[model samples]
Target: MVRYVVIGGGIVGLATAHRITIDQPDATVVVLEKEPRVAAHQTGHNSGVIHAGVYYKPGSLKAGMCRAGQASMLEFCAEHGIDARVTGKLIVATDAAELPRLRALHERSVANGLPVDLIDGDQAREYEPHVAAVAALHVASTGIVDYAEVCRVLADLVTKGGGEVRLGARVTGLRRDGATTVVETTGGAFVADRLVNCAGLHADRIARLAGLTPSARIIPFRGEYYELRADRRDLVRGLIYPVPDPQFPFLGVHLTRMVDGSVHAGPNAVLALAREGYGWGRVKPRDIVDEVAWPGLWRLARRHWAYGLTEVRRSLSRKRFAASLARLVPGITTADIVRSGAGVRAQAIAADGALVDDFLIEQAPGQVHVLNAPSPAATSSLEIAKHIVARFDE
Candidate 1:
């Protein structure tokens, strides 16, 4: 029987394994995760907003996958009895300067074939009474769910389908032996007919380990968040976002009403010292060396130094963070929010100093490497699995 080895236990890896089990029931599938449990990193740390395909560029991989993934994700949730809610989202433009960008986003949304409406401030107020907006794009299909729960369910399904998910199995090396690839791990070595690297933050490293040169390097960006106090959660009924600056890839700090009904805010992007760095205090020398050694890092910094400084300032001060949110909802104040957890994004930067804005996947002989998949990845996890599995046949 054919055997496949998958590295990383995030949503993508588990979903890929599950797809393999379903598509090739006789194949032996093994999943290797360094952490002791599934969803220990990115999948567990995100804000859990199901994207409505509003922000991606038209005709991009993200736009197509996200639109299809939303429906597949909801169907899976319904079949598995996972609690998910269609909360809808509002992209608000508080000032005249932002109106044009908001309008452009509306046109892009329409082009992407999403159900979006451009509403005046009064109409936006009907949805979110406290929101301050000159105009807003209301996307009715956006939703929220606990992705960690989704990961857990995917793990269960993989196991039930005869796949093995081994935790605490960190990969140390990779080699090719004849027609098979040998994956060396702390747990032991396993040989497989094919290998899939969904290592998220460590994807570039994994690609190099597999004897392939990737087009970009993964740069870690820590996204710090804040949650409203229990009493203040009522201020947000759903998701409320600001008009994103077109130059930057991040969708600036915004408020999201989670599955549990708590409101989360402020995920300002800042450079991380380590691939898994969740805070300023969590620094690793090797990770720092990797960043400094890359020419793209310096080039990227030179271009966005001003914006980076602003993000750092926001990360350091709760008052400044709250002030940014207050632009959307006038009543929110520093006293209403408390420091919550943070997540590190595995953003890819090309050698030319440009941020890779699309889902990047690299394939080589007997191996596939997922180089970049940041936001909307969780929302698009199922469809991404199908896409990857189809490659084996190709």
Candidate 2:
């Protein structure tokens, strides 16, 4: 029987393992997760938005995966009695300067086959009454779901499909022994015909453990958030987003209505001192040293220091952060918000300082490494699994 071992028990990895078991039922599958539970990193720390494929380029892996995955995710959630909502999103252009980029996004979304409408300020206000916008793109397919619940269900499916998910199994090394791959983990060693690395925060390190050089280094960016007070939830009708700056990968600070009726706002991206650093105080020495020593970090900083400094100020000042949100929803105030937890994104940056945009997957002898799967990755997990499994055929 074909033996496969998937490392890093995030949603994508779990989905990959589950897909493998379904495709090759007689094959043995094992998932090794360093955390005690699944999706403890990017998957669990996400905004839980089911992306509608509007922001991505047409024909790209993200566009296809997001479109297909959202449908699959909805079906899966329904079958499992999970809470999922198709809360349409509004990508608002607040000023005349943003209209061009907003129109470009509309064109791209149409090319990607997503149903989007360009609505005027009055129409935009009709959707989200508090939003201040000159024009907006109403993306009807955008939605949200609890990805952690999805991961739990996927783990159960893997087990029921005759696969094994081993928690607290940190993979330390990988070596090819003849046609088999030997995975040395904290729990124990496992022999497999193939290995898949889905380690989110430490993905680059995992590639090194397997003696493969990854294309980019994972730079952790802490996305700090604030939640709307319960009484002030009406300020946001649904997901309200800014027309993202084309030069940056981040979608600017905006409002998101969670599945449980709570509204969240602002996830300002700033370089984290630690890979898993949720707060400024939770710094790790090694993570800091690695980040400082990386040449790409300097290159990136040199180019974006102006924006970087602004983000740092916003992080330190509650008023500054609230002001950013007010640009989208003019009614929002600092008192209406409460400091919430943060999530660190494993953003991959090239030596040239360009952030890796698309899903990055690399392969070596008997091993596959997911170097960069950020943002909509949770929404794209199932389709990405299908893509990963197809790599074996090539």
Candidate 3:
């Protein structure tokens, strides 16, 4: 039996641990989480949208994993009696300027074999009456669920498989001895045959701890959100997204109808002061120093300063945030929004200044590091686990 030690208690790590035990019933597994509870970082703070492989390049892992993962996620949710819904999504082009990108996304969607269709403004409005669009891409497979709940269920599955999840166990170091890998955590040390690094926010640091020099550095970007007021929640029927700007890596602010029946709007992406900084006030001095010290950050900023300025403006002004959202849904206004929590994304940037666009998994002597897993990661967790397990088996 292969003994496994998975770092981080997010959905990906939990899924990996659970899949390992499932594939090898007699295998021993241990999941180490820094927080008292699971999904404390990106997994819990996410918008909870199950992406439909629309935005990613065709043939990329994101596209394939998303398609397969969406199915697996729904199946898993159904089997576990979790609340998950295929609310569908519309990627609307508000004006002629966005038509080219919209068509491009449609082509990618079709190439990826996703269930999608190009619709005119009338059809778009039929799906979401509040949206203002000249054209739209209707993705039937898009869905929403509380991913944190999914993490909880995964932890239970891991436990049921004879695995142990140690809470408040922060991994401080990693060392290799013969064929065994020793993981040093705050709670204690655990030795195993293999180590899987799924530490979403601190993945890079974890790689270094394992004596691997990762090619990319993680830069945290805080996506601030606002919830629609109870009375104004009717403005969004389901997920309504804008044709994202090609220059920016972020999916522009969109209106998402969550599983709990509330609508969320405007996740303006801006540089977070800390790795887990959910708000502007939650700053870490070391994080700021590291960010400023990274040349890749400056290179990225210099390239996209104008777009970054817009995001900063929206982040600071409620009216500006609502106005950006209004471009997609005309009925939305600043008053219709209320303060909501933010999610910090661990976006990886290479030394050459380019942002890593796809999922990156690096394998060394006895370790595997998940370097970049941004949006759709929660949606693709199960499929990713399968791929990682395949690598281990090979």
User: Among these predicted structures, which one has the highest lDDT?
Assistant: 1
lDDT of each: 0.94, 0.91, 0.92
lDDT of 2 by residue, 179-225 (tens): 98899999999998988888888999999888887889999999999
> TM-scores of all models?
0.99, 0.98, 0.98
Q: Native-vs-model 3 lDDT?
A: 0.92
Ranking by lDDT: 1, 3, 2
Score candidate 1 by lDDT. 0.94
Clashes of 3: 0
Number of clashes in model 2? 0
Candidate 1 residue lDDT tens string, 1-394: 9989999999999999999999999999999999999999989999999999999999998999999999999999999999998989999999999999999999999999999999999999999999999999999999999999999999999999999999999999999999999999999999989999999999999999999989999999999999999999889999999999988789999999999888999699999999999999999999999888888989999999999999999999999999999999999999999988999999999998899999999998778899999988999999899989888779
Q: Every model's Cα RMSD, please?
A: 0.6, 1.0, 0.9
CA RMSD (A), model 3 = 0.9
Model 1, runs deviating above 4 Å: none
Give candidate 3's error at residue 102 in angstroms.
0.6
Cα error of candidate 1 at position 29, Å: 0.7
